[model samples]
Target: MNETKLRDEIVGLAKSMFDRGLTFGSSGNISVRLDDGWLMTPTGSTMGTLDPARLSKLDINGRLISGDKPTKEAFLHTTMYERRPKANAVVHLHSTHSVALGCLHDVDPANVLPPLTAYFVMRIGTLPLIPYFAPGDLKLAEAVGEMASRHHAVLLANHGPVVAGKTLQDAVYATEELEETAKLFLALQNLRTRPLTSEQVADLHRRFPQNI
Candidate 1:
């Protein structure tokens, strides 16, 4: 999308997420790569009411060039961009269910959520759970960067989830699928739920090989 349309799209989608309670307060951040720089949600800015014109703008090196200060976790977005050349957008949210899954002691560190549904398997093949760092911690961003090249979606321990996508809409759609899957995972925690078998997951991965 062109720069102007990109800005409007970001704002519109952010409002959608906020209105639907995907994120509350100032608990999520979003970014889109640009030819010259990046457009990011400003620090402490709530997604519910983002002003496109005031969104933070950073140069190629991640330094602020205009608008408000970038999100405190801007490094996280920068890391994903640097590590995944094809990713044009990144979405990070302190979403409740995902965070709940992240905080679970028995959750798989390698892949936190199971392939409970085909959409989950296709959109978010595997969800790795990364160790926690306090908010705005660069070390956290470093760890995310370390695996960003291999994993498009990762759950931050005791925190939330982050996803990188080839486009803004791709990232947002994937994120929505992730959140819904997390909710399903938790809802089935004690119901003896039968998730997709390894073979089934492999089939989905084969059919949708782009991210895998």
Candidate 2:
């Protein structure tokens, strides 16, 4: 997509997510990779009202080349790009259910959510938990970089989720699927449930491989 159209798509999709209560109060960030660099939602900007023209443009090294400053969590986006060569977009969101899932103590860090649905398995696959670091900590970026190569989606301990995709739409859709599955995981707690078995999940992986 051209820069102008890509910018508009980011703004439109972000607004749709914001309007649906997927994110609020400037709590989410989105970035799309460009041939030369990347376009990122600005620091402290609300997803509901992002101005495409004012989005941050950064070089491959992540130095701001134009527009306003990038999100303080910009490292989250850059680290994914550095680690995953095929990823063309990254999304970080503080969505409610996913963050709630992160705070729970019993969930496995290696793969937090169960294979609750086929779509979840196809889009997110296994999600690792990155050790929590306070905002703007370089160590946080390090932790994310450690897992980015193998997993396209990760849950930040006590934070939220960071996802990468071949396209911006893919990233956003995967994030949404994650939040919904987290909600299902929470809702089914302490109840008799039959999540997809290992064999079933394996079949899905074979048939619908994720390529982020």
Candidate 3:
């Protein structure tokens, strides 16, 4: 997509996410790769009210080239891009259920969510949990970078999820899936809910190999 179109699409999608309550306040950021560098939501900008013309533009080194300043958490997106060469977009959100899942003391630090549904298995294979680092901490970016090389989606302990995809649409869709699955997992924690077997998950991965 052209830069102008991509900026508009990113803003529109960000608003849609905010409208749907996937994120609230100024709790999330979105970015897409551009030929020149990157286009990202500005620091302190509410996702619901993004003005495309003022979106931050950064060089390959993550230096702000024009528009408003980039989000303090911009490293999260830049580091993921470095780790996953094919990932052209990243979505980081402070969604409720996913963050709630992150808070549970015993939730698996490795593969945080179960294979509760096919879409979860397809869009998000294994979600690693990164230890908490205060917001905008550079250390958190390093941790996410290391893990992101292996997994495109990760849940930050006591925070929320960061998802990378080949496109903005893919990243948004996967983040949405993570939120929904986290909701289902929390809801059925006290009930007898049967998760998809390891064998079934393997079958899906083999069928939709691109998801891996």
Candidate 4:
């Protein structure tokens, strides 16, 4: 997509997420990779009212080139792109259910969410839990980077999720799937449930091998 259309699409999709309460206040961020640099949602800007022309434009080294200042969590997006060359976009959101799942004491760190649905298994595949670091801590970005190459989606301990996709829409869809699955998991906690078996998950992976 051209820079102009990409910026508009980012604003539109972000508003969709914000309106539905996927993110609140200025708590989430989005970035799309560009041949020259990146186009990122500006720091402290609400997704509901992002100005396309004012979106931060950073150079290849992440230096701001134009528009407003980039989100403080910009490193989170940059690191994902650095580690996952095929990823063309990244989304970091403080979505409610995903954050709730992250706070659970006994959840698996290796693969946070169960294979609750085939779509989750396909889009997210496996999600690792990155250790908590204070906001803006470079260590947090490093932690995310360590997992980015292997998993396109990860749950930040005590935070939420960071997901990368071949396209911005794909990233958003994967994040939504993760949040919904987290909600289902929380609801099913007290009841006996049958999550997809290992064999089933493997079959889905085989069938949709291209899923990011």
Ranking by lDDT: 2, 4, 3, 1
Clashes of 2: 0
Per-residue lDDT of 75 in model 3: 92
Off by over 4 Å in 4: none
lDDT of 1 by residue, 73-156 (tens): 898889888898889999999888888888899877999888899999888888888898998788998899878889988889
Model 4, 1-212: lDDT tens digits are 89999999999999999999999999899999999999999999999999999999999999999999999999999999999999999999999999999999998899998898999999999999999999999999989989988999999988999999999999999999999999999999989888899999999989998544
**Model 3: residue 55 alpha-carbon error in angstroms:** 0.4
Distance from true location, Cα of 162 in model 1, Å: 0.7
Cand. 2 TM to true fold: 0.99
TM-score pick, better of 3 and 4: 4
Over all chains combined, what TM-score does candidate 1 have? 0.97
Each candidate's root-mean-square deviation in Å? 1.1, 0.6, 1.0, 0.8
Which is better, 1 or 2, measured by TM-score?
2
Global Cα lDDT for candidate 3 = 0.92
Name model 1 segments beyond 4 Å from true. none
Give the clashing residue pairs of candidate 3, or none: none
Candidate 4 has an lDDT of 0.94
- Which predicted model would earn the best lDDT? 2
